[model samples]
Target: MDFSFSDEQRMVQDSMRAFARAELLPKYTHWDRNDEFPREQWLKMGALGVLGLRVPVDQGGQEADCVTAGLVIEEIARGDFNCCYGILNSCFAGDILGKFASPAVKDTWLPAMASGETVLCVCLTEPHCGSDAAAIRTQAVRRGDSYVLNGEKSGVTLLMVGDAAIVFAKTDPAAGAKGVSAFLVPLDRPGITRHPYSDMGARGIVRGSLFLEDVEVPAGNLIGPENGGFSRVMQTFDYTRALIGLMCLGAAQATVEETVDYLKQRQAFGRPLSTNQGVSFPLAEWSAKMEMARWFCYRTLWLRDQGLPHTRESAMCKMQVPVIAADAVHDCLILHGHYGYTKDFPVEQRLRDVIGQEIADGTPHIMKIIVARDLFGRDFV
Candidate 1:
């Protein structure tokens, strides 16, 4: 199989890289320091066709394939890891809305989201559930023409800034995953409240808790078949996990590149640090591992585009990439000596940011379970 990127893919990567360098790199530190979301930059990215990559062209998106979407995400993360979370949410949520939402809901939200006029967040994890999505406790009870939602969603990305959310809740409390449903709830509703988290990294994209108390949502906002919504939404993660891997890899790649340059120039023991076998060998090893992980991400995306079964591959990407990236960033930090420990260099921040990815989307343990279950029968695994 040919492993090369097409000209169009190369163009997408280059364009996104240029945009990140011009728009994100300069302000990344400021955003990190102030814990400020770059709302303006998000808007600019929307104008650049970055926000709606997964949505079809008719729906105000670029109609890019999964591989191209991953490239855009990776490039953006290279400049500011926090910003990629917004991109991920926009692409993931937009794709879901485009496919499952009613035409009116699509017409209303897709354009606004594509243009960055609105922010969208996904509410899945509840206070009691993290990786085990089937155990979510949030409830959406039907009431004539609407659904009354009452529960708390924790660790919701972009909740503070989001205009709306795609929430998953249990419609049939007695049933397990099959009884779950999804809804597109507008955050302006009276019964919704948000509390932000002061996280160690990715501060620009605030992680928060969303509380719903008798939040009434119109029946028209239901995303898909009531009980079937759980399975449908879970499928989206097969695509998103690879993108998340790429995002983390991008940040780590940037850190590695910076360290390589630093080692070439910094003298130690009467020679450049790169001349030492200790420094060079480990960096070489990490470089190799990172390259392998990068290709794994792209290949998984390509398989998704080909309409192949990629759940196991996607799980592998998500499971391994973040850990690899964390190691790369950590090694790069140690190689930088005292300078890396300070906030003066971006390595420290990259380290914190990439570490969080190990837990984001899905943890390594969860991913391993997925891969194992796929390889062995569920009963055996």
Candidate 2:
């Protein structure tokens, strides 16, 4: 596989980096503090074609390959972590709808989604079932030309602002995994309710809970076949989880930056902090991990472009990147000492945000399990 990025790719990366610095970083902390979603930035992302990077051009997308998507997202994440979460769902939503939604549904939604006029979130995690999505209890009952969706979805990102969601529910409770189905439901429906779920990090990501009380969507809103949606959701994950890995690399890059800034001025034993091997070793280890993790992400993306099976690579990158970032955040905190614990400093916020990522796409333990399953043929315990 060609690991080198083309000139066009480099230009895209550089342009996104510049845009992120100018547009995202300056306002990032303010949004975090105020718990605000920057709709303006999301629009800017749409104008730049950043929101539809990995989506198909036939569906009003830029037709970006997976690596290009990773490049765009990594730059945004490096400058503002929440930008990663927002851009991620922005693009992934359109991708899912384009791939699975019916022609009429796509024709209705894809144009608005591509233009950033509409926002979207995925509703897979029920209050009871999270990563184990097959355990979803949300049920959809057929009611002559409509499906009545009834249940509550939790840990929902972008719900407060999203216009549509790919809601997961059981079409037949007895069928287990085969029973899971997805519906493209609008947030404005009368029976649907969205409320904020306050949390420790990624404040602008706007976490919320979605409640469905006999919410009705047209039969045409069904995405893929009834009782066969788990495959679609996992297919979406196969494309997206790598992007989350790159997001972790961005947070690690920021933590390394804080380390560099503090080391020049911080004193220990009448010398600079960098002079101490105790402080420097962890940072050095983190540096190695980040560098390798970056390349691993790119390679996995390239594999995705080649239509290769990259599930194991995505799981490995997802598992390792956050662990490395967490370690770097741990040291960067001690480097700041008391200042780190205070809200006045950004490191404290960075710490919480990176830790929150461990559970964002898939848990670290789950990633390891995925890798093992991929390697050992599902027979080995």
Candidate 3:
């Protein structure tokens, strides 16, 4: 496959980089310190067509390919890792709505989401089930023209400010994964409770628990065929995992650049620290890894665009990129000395932020399971 980015893709990447440098990087620290979501910047991204990367143009999105979406996310993450969630959620949730929701629902919600007037969060993980999403116990029972939802979703991103959520719950308890279904629930509805987490990183975007106690969702909000959402939701991960990898790489790339610059300027025994093999070698290694990972991520996205099976590639990208990013950021922090350990510097925050990616989407262990299942066949594994 050709690896070169097209002219349009190059323009999209350049535009995102410029926006990040001028708008996001300057204020990311303030948002992190105050635990504030930069809603204004999110709106700016929407206005710039960044939030609507995957949504069809007729639905107020750019109708861009998956690789373009990944490029936009990588650039944004470079400026503020937390803000990349805006893109992730928009694309993930929007894709579902665009594909399965009724025309009315799509017209009503997708445009708002595309314009940043509404934020969408996804609810899949329950209090007891995360990696084993098929084991989720959240129940949605049909009652008249609505489904009354009950149970809690943990580690839900953007819950505090989300206008709506694409919630997955068990519609038929006896069928295991086949029993699952998806619904678009409005967050303002009664019987919904949100409890935000005080997190180690990505503080600007709230991660929280969502409790739906007899929450009434209109029957019209059901997404996809009833009892058939598990496969659909799982398929979206092929796209999202690759984007997550790119996002982590963006953060890692930033830290590596900062460390390299510091090393070049930091004096040690009458010469630059960068000249020393001890200081430079590790940075060089990490830089190479990040570059390789970036290509891997884009390749996964390219596979999706070609309508090919990318489950293995996506799993590999998710498994490797975040770990590499976290290590790179950690080393960058150490290379900066005590100043990097303090909240005064961004490296410490980058380390914390990228570390969370190891758990997001799917853990390394889960990714390994996927890769193994593919390689050895499910029964043999």
Candidate 4:
């Protein structure tokens, strides 16, 4: 198997890395502190083809493949770990609409999203059910030409600033997993309310809780088939989980890179801290793990573009990158000694932010369960 990036892919990685370092790094803390979502950054990245990478050119996108999309994500992450919020906002909702919605729906949403005029959030996780998606309690009842959605979806990224949400709800609660359905619901409606989520990290992310109390959506808003939404919801993870891996992969890379810089600059016993094997060896180990995790993520994307089943691979990547990232960040933090534990140094924030990735896409335990199910049997889960 050839493991080289094409000219276009190499250019994508290099260009996005440059852009992210320039735009995202300087303001990472400011956005986190001020609760600011960069609308202008969205427009800028859209101009750079960072948004809607997979949509057709006629629909105002770059018309790229899944591999190109994954490369863009990985590069964005390499610069600013929190940039994954933008990636998921653009790709997850957009890809789902492109694959499952009608032409009219495509004609309406894709153009604006591609141009960065609108941003979308996915509302699927509820307070009661997270990784166990089939156990959701939000119900949407069909009325005459309309569906009244009444449920709360928690942990929705960027819901506080988004224009719309691609939400999942139970249309036939009795049918269990087959009962779920997807809908594109506008956030400006009467019954929709957004509340900010107070969390330890992801200060750069605009996490929010969505309450849809009798939110009436047009029947035309239904995104896929009536009762077949569960599969679509599951499929949405195919785009996001690996990107989450890339996000943590970026954080892991940042941890090592920053620590290496600190070791060179900081003198210990009248010598550079990195000169000692005690410091150098562990950093080397973290670097090794990070490099392996990075390739695992990209290779999974390659397989995905090849139309292979990547569920098991994604789970493993997601599982491994966080452990690597969390360990690397914390280990590097310890290398910094006192400064690492302080917020002023930013390593602490990197540590805090990387911790969230372990639970976000799927819990570490959930990923392990997926791996077990794949290796042993489906009944293992």
Q: Give lDDT tens digits, candidate 3, residues 7-65.
A: 99999899999999899988878888998988999899889988888887778998889
TM-score of each: 0.98, 0.95, 0.99, 0.96
How many clashes (backbone N, Cα, C below 3 Å) per candidate?
Answer: 0, 0, 0, 0
Ten residues in sequence with the least summed lDDT for candidate 3: 49-58
Which stretches of model 2 miss by more than 4 angstroms?
A: 267-271
Question: How much is the lDDT of residue 182 in candidate 3?
Answer: 95
Q: Write the per-residue lDDT of candidate 1 for residues 241-272, one digit (tens) a residue.
A: 99999999899888888999999999988999
Cα error, residue 51 of model 4, in Å, equals 1.6
Error (Å) of candidate 2 at residue 48 is: 1.1
Reference-based lDDT, residue 354, model 4 = 83
Kindly indicate the candidate among 2 and 3 with the higher TM-score: 3
Better of 1 and 3 by lDDT: 3
Tens-digit lDDT string for candidate 2 (1-381):
456899999999999989988998778678888988878888887788887775568777887888888888888877788877766775676667777789888877776776777888888898877878789899999999999999999998888888989899999999988999989998999999888978888888788999999999999999988987888778768657778878867766876886788887888789997887877787887788788888988888888899998889888888887777777777788877788888776777777878887888789888889999987888893
- lDDT of candidate 2? 0.83
